[model samples]
Target: MIDLNNEKLELNYPCKWIYKIIGKNNQDIKKAVKEILDQREYVLKLSKSSKKGKFKSFTLELLVHNEDDRKMLYDILYNHDNINMVL
Candidate 1:
């Protein structure tokens, strides 16, 4: 089996990246994403929700110019209070 823990993703710059964000409120998550992205071209889609309707998942798709930009976006979204997690 592949060791997922040790496997580092190899990706080319200026490619599409997806951020899977999960949180308690859909609107809150949407607002957070909007604020962070701030007029940048991107696609946001509602993926699914938890069984009890307690959590929501959204996928944010956008083109990242470089490793720093990609990682910066991830950090921005991950640090937001309205966002519970980002993957």
Candidate 2:
């Protein structure tokens, strides 16, 4: 039996990474991402929003140089005050 908890995902370096950034407002999230990325090349698209328009999600796609680079980006987005979640 494979121990899923002990397993890791194998991914090639310099690959495309996608992050779903969620926030209260799409405009605010867009501004926050611009500030956080700061000229870094990335593709941001409006993915979805809550039925009542309380929450919004954006898809952030970018090329990550390596595993560390990918994780670092995730950490940064997850820690930002403007971002509620990063997945």
Best by lDDT: 1
lDDT tens per residue, model 1, 1-87:
767998788998899999999999989998999999997999999999999999999999999999999999999999999999999
Clashing pairs in 2: none
Worst 10 residues of 2 by lDDT: 1-10
Candidate 2 stretches with Cα past 4 Å from truth are: 1-6
Show pairs that collide, candidate 1: none
In candidate 1, what residue range of length 10 has the lowest lDDT sum? 1-10
Q: If scored against the real structure, what TM-score would every candidate get?
A: 0.89, 0.88
lDDT of each model, Cα atoms only? 0.94, 0.91
What lDDT does candidate 2 reach at residue 2?
Answer: 66
**For residues 5-72, could you state the per-residue lDDT of candidate 2 as single tens digits?**
97888999899999999999877898888988896899999999999988899999999999999989
Residue 84, model 1: Cα distance from true site in angstroms: 0.2
